[model samples]
Target: GDPRLQHISQSIRVVPHFPKNGIMFQDITTLLLDHKAFKDTVDIFVDRYRDMHISVVAGIEARGFVFGSSVALGIGAKFVPLRKPRKLPGEVIYEKYSLEYGTDCLEMHVGAVQTGERAIVIDDLVATGGTLSAGIRLLERAGAEVVECACVIGVPEVKGRCKLLGKPLYVLVEPRQVDQCF
Candidate 1:
């Protein structure tokens, strides 16, 4: 309904061969620096779920924390951090999944979401769908009805969308082409 999506797309910085060769790393730090763009991104997400009866917002480790917490605050829901092993305190349930490089695990506190609470999982990007998929499994196992998985960006070329196992995925934007940075 507005130019917020364009702002988000423009604020991201694409780095060539980051963390490895042949990888175009999509960076969002630039977006964070642009207060308006950042706020709009969160507002867009909040608007989507504010009235959906979402009791919880499950944010994946790292990037998800940025937008997820804001959305939770805006929507009046609890924010749960789905973290790496040993990051979450007390009794936690974990799910291990394979990524392009290796296998990793995500852990959430056992009581983060009570039985039947509606939740939405957030991540910065969906690359290969491993991280979001694992988060969904972790939440579902604990009896949370994951409303949907949301990401700021999606690399459809990686086929992460297909690996979601029928869960709805919402992305703000996909690169128009591999060569287009914004």
Candidate 2:
């Protein structure tokens, strides 16, 4: 059997009516406050791909940076950022996708991932998988082989798993609902 990953699964707080009503946001600040939890979260990815030849760790913007940077550092790999439009400097490659509310675009430096390098995309959570999918496409277009995609949390109700069908996905925690607590 695959190693049980429940220990790293944490119950995070949910702030109801956040940014808008009827939307309960999964707050990861609680998990960030715990050092052991943070380390374990990073360890989950490091342990899984320790032997793989990962040249870059591509982290989705904002929350992804937190976990991705640390994992990249731990594994002695370079960290690349997948950011929202206009956030990154220099020549950037862009991909547009629809969000739950509206459409948005993600940008990355043209040369962030070198040709033929292996990368692991990291993010804090996977919801509909739109952003993650865009990230994968962007990396592939730049000639990077996406070895895997990993996240700290995954919300299956939104068809997140289906969006990542062809990729190896590793999540530290798989929660039924975004609002569900540990």
Candidate 3:
């Protein structure tokens, strides 16, 4: 990882027991607040992909949108948003993946990605790899060759990378875990 990424790693705020128990949530909202850190986060991604001949950058909903659009612009690739169900109004294709509780789906507009286009998926964090896997499947099913998945933070202990089906994953920071001290 780049030395500058240290700042990116430190900027993340970890919240314990978020929406449940014994779960440490790696939050990037704090990173979004620091202008330099935020810009650096996007810059690091842009620099990595700018020379890769990438044609499409698919962001996995909500948080992925933040970095994806900027990276697409910087890399001269088209930005494609893989959204939640029914969030897109046009013709779409979707892929569903399992979660700890239930299943969730990701939708992409039909014809958003051309056949044989090289693409990457961006998100803020990757935990279970379920959502990222669905995003890759959605793009691959559309005939796009998914080149990689990128994220700001990663939780290695959860082994999210195992679910990506051999697709490469890149992360700027490995999360720092702290006990729930309140």
Candidate 4:
């Protein structure tokens, strides 16, 4: 199915110097504030995977939670959180990856995804694809098959590093300048 990038593009706000210097954060908070926009973002994912058998929806830390949970609810699938280091309460499988600012780690609950479960990883954006790669590794370690990845936005320049080639990628929008705010 063809994804609609226009609506998602219109809803995002480019914020400069967020979290630190030289980083242009793609703020989806503005999109979340609008009901229609928020629903559209979720709908895009739901439509894309309507025919696929998705048992769980895994969202990356922080921002990914906002959209991932909504998509999970919309599609009637379980929601799993791929969180920051030491965030998960119980036993977790961890993976470390580099971020735009510095190095960081992501973790998932020990039993978040059962063996052979079909899962989809969701995030707000994919820049360097570091976070997404970490999430994929963690899920695979837990014995889940990652069917696809969904993001609100994709920065192709960063993805060109060859981190996201074999995965089926779906994005609501792809901005020309992912680091413009920096």
TM-score of each: 0.91, 0.87, 0.92, 0.87
Tens-digit lDDT track for model 2 on 1-182?
23434444544556777878876666677778877777777886788766798989999989999999999988888999999999887999999988987999989999778899999999988878888898898999999999889888876553233437378777666652455454
Off by over 4 Å in 3: 157-163, 179-182
Q: How many backbone clashes does candidate 2 have?
A: 1
* Model 4, C-alpha of 132: deviation from truth (Å): 0.4
**Per-residue CA lDDT of candidate 3, range 87-151, in tens?**
99999999999999899999999999999999999998887888989999999999999988998
Pairs of colliding residues, candidate 2: 11-182
Off by over 4 Å in 2: 1-7, 157-165, 176-182
Write one digit per residue (lDDT tens) for candidate 1, span 13-56: 88778879988788888789899989999998899898899999
**Per-prediction tally of clashes:** 0, 1, 0, 0
lDDT of each: 0.86, 0.80, 0.87, 0.80
Worst ten in a row by lDDT for model 1 = 156-165
Candidate 4 regions exceeding 4 Å error are: 1-4, 157-165, 176-182
* Ten contiguous residues minimizing lDDT sum, candidate 2: 156-165
Q: By TM-score, highest first, what's the ranking?
A: 3, 1, 4, 2
Residue clash pairs of candidate 1:
none
* lDDT, model 3, position 44: 88
